[model samples]
Target chain A: MLKDEELDLLTGLLSEKYGYDFNNYARASLKRRVGRLMAIDRFPSFAELLHKVNHDAAYLPRMVQSLTVNVTEMFRDPSVFKTIRESVLPVLGTHPLIRIWHAGCSTGEEVYSMAILLEEANLLHRSLLYATDLNPMVIENIKKGIFPMSQMKVYSENYILSGGKKDFSRYYTAKYDWAKFDENLKSRMIVATHNLVSDRSFNEFQVIFCRNVLIYFDKTLQDHVLNLFDDSLEKLGFLVLGSKENLRFSSISKKYVQSDEKEKIWRKMK
Target chain B: MAKNEMNGFKVVAIGGSAGSLETILAIVQGLPKSPGAAIIIIVHRKNDLESILANLLSFKTHLVVKEVEDKDPIYPDHIYIAPPDYHLLIEDEHSFSLDSSEKVQFSRPSIDVAFESVAEVFAGRAIGILLSGANSDGAKGLLKIRESGGYTIVQNPATADMGYMPQQAINLGAAQHVLDADALVATLNGLF
Candidate 1:
C-alpha cells in the first residue's frame, strides 16, 4: 500500500509540475500504475518516482500514456456500426455539414472505421471527423492512417458485418506487413490530443462515439466524461458505445432514448 | 500498535456479471461475520432495484450487510452491496460514490468498474475477487490489483457455476489464489 504521505506527494507533484491531475482517479489502480512505473524505472520508492516525475518533463507524459487504456479495434462491436448505418446516417445526412467526434480514440481503428462508413454512405464530403486521444503517438498514427496488414482479414470481416457496400480491400493498400489506408479517407479526419480528464468541450458534434473508454475510469471520472460528451453533442445528436457498454444508467440516460438498444445506439431526447 | 497510526483498510471488492449471486452467497457464508475488514459486493443489474442480498446473507454471518449509498464511509465488519444501475467506486477517504454512467460489459454496476476503483483506492491494501461470472469484465481490473501489490483471489474455474470469468482472470495472471469459494473465504479470513 502506498503511504498517505506518498500519495499526497505524488498527487501534488503531478498537479503542480505537470498540470495532470490523477488525484481524483481510483486510488488502487493509480497506485498500481505508479508502482509499476517505479519498479520498471528502478526507483527505490514512491517518493523517488515522484521526484523524477516532478523534475523530468518527459517522464510524466510517458507515464500518462502508459496509464491510459488504449485497447481498441476497427469496427469493434460490428452490430453498433450496422445500427449507425441504418439509423444514424439518415439523420446526419439531412444536415449540410456533419461533425463527428471520436473521443479517446485509441489506436485510431474506430476513427478509421467511422471514416469508411461515412465514405460508403456518400457523406464523406460533407462530414468532418475529429479523432482525439491523450497519447500524441496515437494521434500521429491516426494521421498516418496505417495499420498492420495481418489484421486486415478480421477487420474486413467486421466491415462486411457492419454493412459495408464496397470491397473493404479498396480502402487500404498492403505494403509489406503494413496496410496504408487511402489518403482520401484520412483527409476528412482531424486527429489531435484531447485529454478527457482535463480538457473541456471545444466543438459541438453531430455524433459522438466514446466506446470502451469509460470502463477504465472510476465513477466520478465516468460521470465527468459523460457530461463532457453530452455538452459537446448538438441537439438530437447520436451517441454510440461498445456492445458491452450502455447509457441507460447515466445522468444523461434520461435525455437520450435508445435508437437501437441492442446496438447501443442512442439519440438525444432533450 | 499505535492507535493513531494510519492503518489502511484491507478492503476486498468483488464484482460479478452473471451466475454471481450463488457464488457470492457461498463465499459470504464461509467468511466470518466480523472479519475486521470490509467487503464490497457489486452485482451487475439493469436497474436500481431494492436488494434483498444483505438480508439473505445476514442469516449466514454476523457481518452487517447493507446496500452502499453515496458518500457512505466504509466500515470494517460490514458488507456493502452496490445497488443496481450505478457504478460503485471508493474514495480516497474510503467512502463510496455511485456513478450512473454508461455501462460496461453490457451491464450497469460492472465488475471491472468496481474492481478498478478498488484497485485505485486500496492499492496494496485492496483485495480483488472474481467470482462465477460469465464474462471477462473483472480480468483486467484483477490484473491491475495484482500488479499494484494487492492480493487477488479468483474462484477456481472447476468450482465456479460459470467458469469464464475465473478462467480469464487466471489467464491474465491476476489471481494469486485460484481457490474454491469456500477456500477463498478462508484465505481472506486468514490474511489479517
Candidate 2:
C-alpha cells in the first residue's frame, strides 16, 4: 500500500504535470485504489510507481482510472430510479426541452438507464442527456452503448424493480457476450469529458445525476461539487445522489428539499 | 461490567449471516444503553428495502441506531447497520464511506471489507465480533483485527445457530475469546 506522504507526492506530481487535481479526494479510498493499482501493475515499491507515472505519460490514464471508483451498474439502487421514473420524470415533462446532466457518468450505464425511462415516459424526443466524465475512455464506451452480457441479468432485475414494464432485454441486442443498447437512445445524448474538480458547469439543467461521485471527494471538494450542481440546476429542478450520499450536509442543502425522504432525489426549492 | 475496558475503542464491528439475526438481537438487548463505542453490524442481506432490520435492532437497544449512509460520521454510543447492496468501509478514524464495489464472499457489505477497513483505521482501538453464520467472510478480517492488536471474539461454535462462521475464525486463530451467548454478554459488559 502507498504511504500517506507517497500518495500526497504522487497527487502533487499529477497535478503539476497533468493538471489533475486529486489533492482534495478522500484519502482512504484513493490510497487503497492506488495501492491496488501498484499491486496489479507489479510495482515493487512506491518509488517504482512514482517513476513510472512521472516518466510515462501513457500511464497517466490508467493511473486515473484505477484511482477513481467506477463500479456502477444499470438502474443501480432501483428505488432511486423508480422515484425518478414516478416522481421526477412527470415534473421534467412539463419543460419544452428537458435538459438532464449526468455528472461523472462512468461507463454510461445510468445515463442509458435514464434514457430508457424517458423513452417509456414518451419524453425521449424532447429531452437531451448530457453525459460527462473525467475519463475519455469511458466517454467512448458511452458512445458504443455496449455493456457486458453477464451484467444484463442483474440490470434486468434492477430494471424490473425500478417499475420498468417493458422486457428489459428489448433495450439491447445481444452480440455474443456483449449487450449493445438501442442506437436511438444514444441519439439524444451529448457525451463529453468534463472534470468536476476543475471544470465549470456548462449549462443549466432540469435534473442532474451525480450519484456516488462525491463520496470519493473530501468535504471541501464535496461542497465545491455540490455548489456546482446548485449553479447548474434550474429552480424546481431535481438533483439526485447515490443511495447513501447527502445534499443535506452541504451549503446548498437549504435551497433543496428532498423530493422523496426515502430516496436521494432532491428538488431545488429556491 | 468489564469496567470500561472498551472505552478507548472507537469501533465495534460485528459480522454474521444466516441464523445470526437472533444472536444480534440478543447481543443488542444485552448491551448497556451506552457502550462507549460505535457498533457496526454487517449481516448478509438479499433485499435492498429492509430498513426493517435497523428498526428491529433499534427496538432492542437504547443506543441510537440507523442504517449507515455514505460519509456518515462514527460516534460513540451509536449503532450503525450496514445498508443492503453496498459495502460499508471505514473511510478513516472518524467516518465511513459506502461502496457499490464487487461483492466479497458473494456478499456486499461483506464482513471482510468492513473488518479489514476497521483494522486499518482503528488498529488497536477496534473490536471484532464474529457470530453465527455459514460463510467464511469474517475469518480473515477477524485475523486482521487481531494482528493489528485489537480484540476479537467469536461465538462458541457449539452454541451458535450455525457454527461455520465462528468455527472458521477459530480455525484461523482469529478470536481471543470463544464464548456462548450468555458468556459473550458477560464478557462484553465486562469491557464496559
Candidate 3:
C-alpha cells in the first residue's frame, strides 16, 4: 500500500497540474486506491507514478479510473432500494412528470434499478433518468447494458429482496455469456460523463442519488458536492444516498429532513 | 479518571469478530461513563444488514454510541462502531471517513481495516484491543499498532469463545496485555 506521504505528494501534484482536485479525498481511502494502482501497474514510487501521469497519456486515464473506485451492483443493499420503492416512489408518483439524476453512476446498475422500480410503480413512461459518471469507460460499458449472465442469479435475488414482483427473467435475455437487459429499460436512461469534482448540475431533479461516491472525498469536497446536490434537487424532492452516507455531518444536513433515515433517503425541506 | 492520564491516550480502537459482543458489552460497562479518548470498535459483521451494535452497546454505557457515518468528526468520550458493509477510516486526527470498498479478510467492517486506519493517524497515542473472533484479521493490524508504539491488548485465548483472532495477535507478539473480559476492562480503567 502507498504511504500517506506518497499519496499526498502525488494527489497534490495531480490537483496542481491536471485540474483533478484530490487534495480533499480522505487520506486512507485515497491511499488504498493509489496503492492498488501501484501494484496493478507496478510503479515503484509516487515520483515515477506522477511522472508517468504527466508524460504518458494512457496512464492518466488509468490513474483516474483507479482513483475513482467505481464498484457497484444492481439493487445493492436491497433493503434500501426497497425503501425507495415503498416510500419515495409513491410521493414521486403524485408529480406530473419526474426527473431523476444519478450522479457517479458507475456501470449504471442503480440507474437501471431505479428504472425498474419506476417502471413497476407505473412512473417509467413519465420519468426521465439521467446517469453520469467521471469514467468514460464505465459510461461506455453502461451504455451497452450487457452484464455477465453468471451474475443473473445473484441479481435476481437482489431484485426480489428489493420488492420486485415480476419475473426477473422477463426483464432480460440470456445470450451465450451475458445477460442483456430489456432495451426499453435502456431507453429510459441517458448515460454520460459528468465529473462530480468539476461539473455543474445540468438540470433539476425530483430525486438525486450519489450513493457511495462522496465517501471518496474529504470533508471540504463532500461539503461542496452536497451543496451541488442541494442546488439540483427541487424543493421537497427526495435524495437517496448510500446506506452508509448521511446528511448529518454536512453543512446542508439541516436543509434536508429524514424521509427514511435507515435508507439514507431524505427530502429537501427548504 | 485522572485528567493527565486520560489525556495521555487520544484514541482507543477495539477489533473483533465472532463471540465478541459479550466482551464488548463488559468493556463498555466497566469503562468510565465518558471515556477520555475517542473510541472506535470494528467487528466482522453481516455485509448487508443494518447494524444495531451501536444501539445495543449504547444501552449498556453512558457514552453516546453511534454507528459511524461518512465524515463523522471523531469526538472523544463517544463510542463509534463501524457500520455494516462500510470500512471505516480516520480521515484526519479529528474526523472519520468511510468507504464501500472491497472487503479485507473476507469481511467488510474488517477489524484490520479500522485498526490500520487508527494506526496510520493516531500511532503511539492509540490503544488497540483484539478480542474473541474466529479469524486472523486483527493480527497484522495489532502488530501495526504495536510497531507504531501504541498499546495493544488481546483477549486471553483460553477464555475466548472463539480464540483464533486473539491467538493470531498473540502469535504475532501483538499483545502488551492479554486478559479476559473483566481484566481487560480493569486495565483500561487503570490507564485513566
Candidate 4:
C-alpha cells in the first residue's frame, strides 16, 4: 500500500503533469485505489509506480481509469427509477423540452435506462439526455451503447422492477456476448467528458443525476460540486443523488426540498 | 464503560451471511447498553428496496441501530448497518461514504470491502468478527484486519450455522480467537 506521504507526492505529480485536481478526493478510498493499481500493474515499489506515472504519457488514461470508480449498471437501485417514473416524469413532461444531465455518468447504463423510461413515457423525442463522465473511455462506451450480454439478465430484471411495461429485450439486440442497445435511444443523448472538480456547468438542466460521485470527494469538493449543480439547475429543477447521499446538511439545503422522504430526489424550491 | 473507553479498540466490524443473523442476535442481546465502540454490520442481503434488517436488529439492542447513510458520522455505542446495493466505506476517521460502483465477490455489501476499509482507517484500534456464512467473502478481509495489527475473531466452524465463512478464515489463519456464540459474547463484553 502507498504510504500517506507517497500518495501525496503521487497526487501532486498528477496535478502538476496532467492538470487534474485530485487533492480534494477522499484520502482513504484514493489510497486503496492507488494501492490496487500498483498491485494489478505489478509495480514493485511506490517509487517505481511514481516513475512510471511521471514518464509514461500513454499510461495516464489507465491511471485515471483505475483511480475513478466506473462501476455502474442499468436501472441500478430500481426503487429510485420507479420514483422517477411515477413522480419525477410527470413534472418534467410539462416542459416542452426536457433537458436531463447525468453528471458523472459511468458507461451510460443509467443514461440508457433513462432513455428507456422517456421512451416508455412517450417523451423521448422531446428529451435530451446529457451524459458526462471524467473518464473518456467510459464516454466512448456511451457512444457505442454496447454492454456485456451477461448483464442483460440483471438489467432486464431491473427494468421490470422499475415498472418497465414493454419487453426489455426489445431495446437491445444480442450479438455474441454483448448487448447493443437500439440506436434510437442513443439518438437523443449528447455525450461529453466533464470533470466535476474544475469544470463549470455549461447548460441549465431540469434534472441532474450525480449519484455516487460526490462520495469520493471531500466535504469542500462536495460543497463545490453541489453549488455547481445548484447554479446549473433551474428553479424547481430536480437534483438526484445516490441512495445514501443527502442535501440536507449542505449550504444549498435551504434552497431545495426532497421529493420524497425515502427517495434521494431533491427539488430546487427557489 | 469507562475502562473500555480507554481500550485500544474503537470499532467492531462484523461480517456475516446466510445463517449468521441468529448469531448476531445472540451477540446483540448479550451486549450492554454501552459497547464503548461503534458496531458496523455488513451482511449479504438481496437488492431489495425495503430491507427490514435494521429494524429487526434494533429490536435486539439498546444501541441506536439504523441503515447507514452517506457521510454519517461514526460514534461509540451506535450500530450502523450497510445499506442495500451500496458498498459502505469509511471516508476517514470520522464518517462513512457509500459507493454504488461495482460489486465485489458478487455482493455489493461485500464483507471484504468494509473490512479492508476498517483496517485502513482504524488499524490497531479495529476488531473484526467473521460469523456464519456460506461464501468466502470475509476470509481475506479478516486476514487484512489481522495484518493491519487489529484483532480478528471467527466463529468456530463447529458452532457456525453454515461454517464455510469462519472455516475459510480459520484456514487462512485469520482468526485471533476461534469462538462459539457464548464465548464470543464473553470476549466482546470483556472488551467493553
Q: Which candidate gets the maximum TM-score versus the true structure? A: 4
Candidate 2 has an lDDT of 0.89
DockQ of each: 0.11, 0.52, 0.61, 0.64
State how far residue B32 of model 2 sits from its true place (Å). 1.3
DockQ, model 2, C-alpha based:
0.52
lDDT of 3 by residue, A176-206 (tens): 9998888888787888899888889799999
User: What TM-score, to 2 decimal places, does chain A of model 2 have?
Assistant: 0.99
Which runs of model 4 end up more than 4 angstroms from their true locations? B1-9
Question: What's the TM-score of each model vs. the native?
Answer: 0.64, 0.95, 0.92, 0.96
Query: Over the stretch B1-192, how does candidate 1's per-residue lDDT look in tens digits?
Result: 112123765787887767778878877887864677788888776441455676887777778887875556788878889876566766554577655454667766777777877776667778888888788888988888887678999988897889998899999999898998777878877976
The best candidate in terms of DockQ: 4
Question: How many clashing pairs per prediction, in order?
Answer: 11, 5, 0, 0
Docking class of 2: medium
Query: Weakest 10 consecutive residues, lDDT, candidate 3 chain A?
Result: A1-10
Per-residue CA lDDT of model 3 for B1-192, tens digit only, reads 112432444788999889998999888888886568888999877765455777788789888888888888888898888888788888877778897877889888778878887887788878999999998898988988888878999999999999999999999998998998888999987765
C-alpha lDDT of all candidate models, in order:
0.78, 0.89, 0.85, 0.89
- Candidate 4 lDDT score at position A144: 98
What does the lDDT read for residue A2 in candidate 2? 54
Candidate 1 stretches greater than 4 Å from native: A1-5, A242-250, B1-192
Docking category of candidate 3: medium
Off by over 4 Å in 3: A1-5, A249-254, B1-9
State the local distance difference test value for candidate 1.
Answer: 0.78
